[model samples]
Target: MTTELTDAELLDAFHRQIRLSGREDEPAPGIVRDTDGPVARRYPQEPGTSYCMIESPRGLGDDPDHWIRRQVDFFTGRGEEVEWKTYSYDEPADLTERLARAGFVAEDREALLLGEVEGLIHDVELPPGVQLRQVDSDHDLGRVDELMRTIWGPGRDDGALTREMRADPEALDVVVVEESPEGPVLCAAWLRYSPGTDFASMWGGSTLPQWRRKGLYRATVAYRAQLARDRGFRFMRLDTTPDSRPILTRLGLRHVADTTPYVLDARRGA
Candidate 1:
């Protein structure tokens, strides 16, 4: 029987799984902080860009607006541009308006999905001659990098990609499927584990144009979900654009909410 679940139930289950997987430890020390009120603090992926996380302020003791201003000043003081990810279910409290007032540009929102690892990792048929492989060495890394650039466009510096790859080998797995006549046409990667969470996040699901709708993407999803299940992850999470939403929904991932990243260009008005 199919094990479909409600969005809330799936999200709760997914969160529980994340706790069990121990993947939540990936964030740095100051990357996640608690503010005086319903607001929390978060850091960026690197020093150059300012990225922050704001959690639900339900029942928190302080003013959310005041806390947000504090967060803005905290990152702005560092002479860096700031980005904040806000979820659909989050109490608006004029947060987006406040952000706009502070010169933050709002970007498109993406769907936040959560599902059980097993729900995604089912048996799948692969296209004939398409071979799946795990990347391990420098050569493999280079190949993965090349595939990323080829499928997604160029301009990624080698140093940055290498640094990212090195920092979280366990968390990041680059998997690819190669087809003979078309060459290697499918490429994707996932964050296999989160330190304190039972969640594994899938990223970089880029497929070449000629290979679209060929079942390659679904197979890759199953492959990674199996890997995550084997690693004991309970939940699988991904941010999806409209193009991929149908695929994920078919895979049994329920939409938790939508998320948007708002960025402020410090150089423009500083």
Candidate 2:
């Protein structure tokens, strides 16, 4: 069993390489690491996101103000949303300041956690009545989406989800909890595999208030981690909300860094 990466190694490898790796889903054109910043570029079709800009790094274009507008204009010109994935350890420490000055709003802060799947790969036991299964049909998709919608509320779109599920059902494995295999879904979560990197990222790990602490979420994590391991991924990563920090930490995932997403509306800027 492989051990997880240290903070420094994870940051360096993840930002410089794996973060830009094609998950084998979309074209390589979607992600570009330019002199200004690493961007997940999806013009007209989707919003573009920027990541990891070295502040005041000598050489390629160091004018922060001008460079900031250039980035803002690139997206605003396309009427796309701008998300800057900022880390606490990022250099030019004022990168967040610059982002805020550029009119980007900061989203929730989360601790990035990484773990090897070795110890967590066992079959996790949910309460006797609960069972878990991989979502395989539109009916399952709808049920899982509805469960998430109820927990997360309105404003979140299932369009991207639907498209992803249709495009590559295997890469994004969504697992749901139900009373029976075909019963109403009580909770749901997903595991996304990135073949280019040895890491799998966990998303939508939520449960209904009624379903809390019955080990459902943990089971979901175990199931997904084992799935990733079975598929050959060496590590699992997730941005843990403060509420989820304790549970994941106890499970042995190391806290690497704090990540805050800064968003700027291109439409508003235009």
Candidate 3:
């Protein structure tokens, strides 16, 4: 039953599975579309907080400002940091304005990409001395996290690469590219799958500062795509920074939408 889907169908499929999929398999329950519109909040809240919006806002309601306030109050009341994500294609195109006006600082804007997984090119070789492989060991996790600390500096914590991933291996397929078996880590990337959907989203695809301009990043993308394809996933989605967006675009992925994170850090607001 290999039914091919149109671009609109792929975009719709993305929303149906992701925007509706309970925050990528976290214990979080159904989509939150109550007074605040559809969102999926993180549980066991920390000092700072962020949640994903489950749907577009065009027709979500007549007044996005009012809706955004409610959403902000929901997070602020609990003293959690808030990151209200907005998409370029979201309804009420001015949702970005509403988010900014609500006192949420705009973070990086990225291209949302979707690609079919079948026959993706993964045979590309790494640089002469590098090797790529899948790993889930604590050693690898620590090494990669340390690299993140270096790149992002000592202050950047591990929210995205949290202990949850180590606690739940079935939820992640991580791939790291190393300059050598025992050498310093060059780069690492990971992918996560939704249990009952055609989508698997890639995350944390970053290279060390000096490792850019090489083919390792592209190889990592192909590696993850083929891994998902082999596991029966039909489509691959990734939110990319400008550096990777062009590469992903060249790989035949569709530029479906763009998302910017609007953050309300509890620490700063205090």
Count of steric clashes across candidates, in order: 17, 0, 3
Sort by TM-score, top down from the best:
3, 2, 1
Q: Between candidates 2 and 3, name the one with more favorable lDDT.
A: 3
Best model per TM-score? 3
Question: What TM-score would you give candidate 1 relative to the actual structure?
Answer: 0.78
lDDT of 3 by residue, 210-253 (tens): 98888888888899988888778889888888878888878878
Cα lDDT tens digits, model 1, 64-99, are 566666766767776666566666655665677777
- In angstroms, give how far residue 247 of model 3 lies from its true place: 1.3
Candidate structures ordered by lDDT, highest first:
3, 2, 1
Worst 10 residues of 3 by lDDT: 27-36
Which has the better TM-score: candidate 1, or candidate 3? 3
Question: Residue 147 error for model 3, in Å?
Answer: 1.2
Error of 3 at 252 (Å): 1.3
